[model samples]
Target: MKRPTTGRSRHSGGPNVGRPGFAWALPATIFFALFAIVPLIGVAVMSFTSWSGLGSPEFNGLDNWNKLLGDKVMMQSLWLSALLTLLGVVIQTPLSILLGVWAAGQQKNRAVLSAIYFIPLLLSSAAVSVLWRALLDPNFGIPGQLAGIFGGDGNLLGSQAGAIAVLTFVGAWQFTPLHTLLYQGAARSVPPVLYQAAEIDGAGTMRKFFSITLPQLRNTIVTSGILMVVGGLTTFDTVLILTKGGPGTDTTITPYYMYRKAFQSFDFGVGSAIALVLVVIATAISLIMVRATGYDKMNSAQEGI
Candidate 1:
């Protein structure tokens, strides 16, 4: 049986009543509509048109999309994007979790090591890309032994497999710290009492981690995952600076391909179409992740107890 709410309504959200109202979000909502929605709508419209940057756009129906359908590079780009994003998630998640959990501990030199780990995250994307490019250069940066291990002459950007490996490694190198920071904050927030109780139950480190730490970090994991997926799909500067979609479109992910079509090839229509496709794919993936993980409806892990 449902009881009538007296002090405040059941819903703790939305406008009016005893809670923060719609006005609180109105400004941000309007800003988003104006900038994000308006620009997206314009891009959608432009996707169905033919235009270079010099002149007014002219409606061209679905020609742009039709071209994408027949483009092998476009298909390959999508696959590359998916592959890199998957690899990033697979590699970063556990590593970040471990590093973050460790950083949250009272271990010696944790502060110094954590600071070092965070350095890559501070540099701009272009800077990281250029740094890697020089470091991976066969003649100059990478040591001969490491170079041989990487790709014979260490020309990582020269071959599809090596290029893909470099991108994956670089992506993980730069972004792992960001996700680790998220997990660190979350891990720190977890009540020490939980661990104390687990210890009393004869639980080991692995047991406590699996039973308590991981479960408590569910929301943080989902948030970090979403960021990784979105960032991977939209990654461009690294591909441009490091590989240049090079060695015959081998490392050309969707975003880089879109850049080439729009700015390099001067095919604005096709580029706009690709951009819209990327937006749709990213949006769908994020929404699906949120829904599947129950992130949208989830309360704090320790809410009731």
Candidate 2:
């Protein structure tokens, strides 16, 4: 006997029903191929060649890589980049978390406080650089005047150590608000029951924060730390505008050095190699952070629960 006809036939659609998934993904695939994949491949290929912008690229295998290994300036740039990343993460993380927690717990003036905190983020990097440059001017800047009052020179941008410190501080100042916002969202998502339970147990604010708030924000902290590290490593505009990697390459982080090599010196090959190295370093660091924090496992366990 023939089966009764169904409203829909599974065999009729078969796997064809899922064929449209590729169609939906086509635009994104094309975009990634054209922009990300293509450029990455081009950069990788160019890293092995001596390519002046105007001339045809000449294959010079390992020459650029060899130079990169022994170049003192390049080494300095890499070390400086690492230092900036460390300083930025160290300074921004705790400050942001504290500010975020405080702002989230506020019963009044929350909006106003948030707005004020985000003002630095709203300003363009160029603008911030210019503003700080003026404020740090040795001749007449506020910082310089304060230094003079202390019977010291006000030329913060004139010394290598001072330039590095100022740049690090500027980076932290510009980005801490963004971290604060991230932490605020994470803080607010914590279950109210957790805090209440802590209170009932006679836990004070600091105790509850350590026991509940921080533990809940582990993923966010890791995520933000990675982002801040990457940002610090790739920092350019503010450094470019304010210091121009001045005081004898003291502030010339890897990205700015890469820029100088590619554009100023017209050495695209060396620059491409540096760029690839940076990409590898950043990716490895991010992976290490995720692994150390057990971020993936935590996410999976959370989902399972």
Candidate 3:
């Protein structure tokens, strides 16, 4: 016989009542708080002040926030960031998903396909930038020389639209491989039985892909899309080396613009404010992606789909 209790322990209803994993997570929690949370709090504080990173910080209240509203360059950078995020999400997301699906289908040659997809990711961003810079060179570059054939202007990197185009393409190229691998792994984990069933049902390749593969890969797609969004938001290395935010700020996304403000002009206050804005924008974007892509619910629906 067991003794019945009138009242239960406070944590009696929860699975975590005696979990060791929670205890083990304490160190990481403390580390994240110390590094991420503390710095973020400091930045939030600094955003409200007018500190030049040299002298005393003056309390400016909401002055910086108001300034952000009317600052043309800052606004332009935000727009540029938005545009890059759009292009990246549009171009990279579907392409990576398709590549992952194709790689999954190439089971016999999966290793070769994966290696080809991953090679670009292994290269340093600086090297990729240098390669593209040479390729876009007006005098000797292939793209520029090709443009000359169409009677088009040969200096792609030297024009605002061209700079944005090149930067966006480079951004897509660098990030697509990572997302491809992620989706490929996810696709590989999907049961082969599903594909067999689809084939048995007289489903064509395109139908199987659209009806079976795509639905199954939704979670992976959303996860990789979020990653692409983050990459778009903070892209710097390639843009720095390729366009250098040139052609009159057309390609100057938020991060690069913030870098210029903080490092080049030595405007720490404005730079800090821009940094805070970027953080907010990034956070908002992540939230939006989660909502738009149904990412949070995709895992629960993955097996059924």
Runs with alpha carbons beyond 4 Å of true place in candidate 3: 1-31, 145-153, 287-305
lDDT per residue (tens digit) for residues 1-305 in model 2: 43323323335555333323335668999999999889888888889999889869899999999999999999999999988889899999999999998888757798689889999999999999999999988788987667646346778888888888889888878999999999999999999999888889999988998999999999899889888988888899998999999987888989999999999999999999999988888779878887977879889897443
Report the backbone clash tally of model 2.
Answer: 0
TM-score sort, best first: 2, 1, 3
Q: Cα RMSD for candidate 1?
A: 5.4
Q: Which lDDT value does model 3 have at 68?
A: 73
In terms of lDDT, model 1 sits at: 0.89
lDDT of 3 by residue, 1-305 (tens): 33323223346555434434445768999999999999888778877888666878787888877877788888898888888788889988889888877786656787787888788798899999998888778778876557646346678887787788788788777778898888888888888999899889999989988888888887777777777778788888888999888887878878888888777887666777899987887798789887877767888687343
Q: Please, what is the whole-model Cα lDDT of each candidate in the order they appear?
A: 0.89, 0.87, 0.80
List model 1 lDDT by residue over 1-305, tens digit each: 33333334446552324644456678999999999999899889999999888879999999999999999999999999999999999999999999999898877799789889999999999999999898887678674447545546656677788889899999999999999999999999999999999999999999999999999999899889999999999999999999998789998999999999999988999999999999898889889787867766666554332
- Lowest lDDT 10-mer window, candidate 3? 1-10
Which candidate has the highest lDDT of all?
1
In model 3, pairs of residues that clash are: none
In model 2, where do residues sit more than 4 Å from their true spots? 1-20, 148-151, 286-305
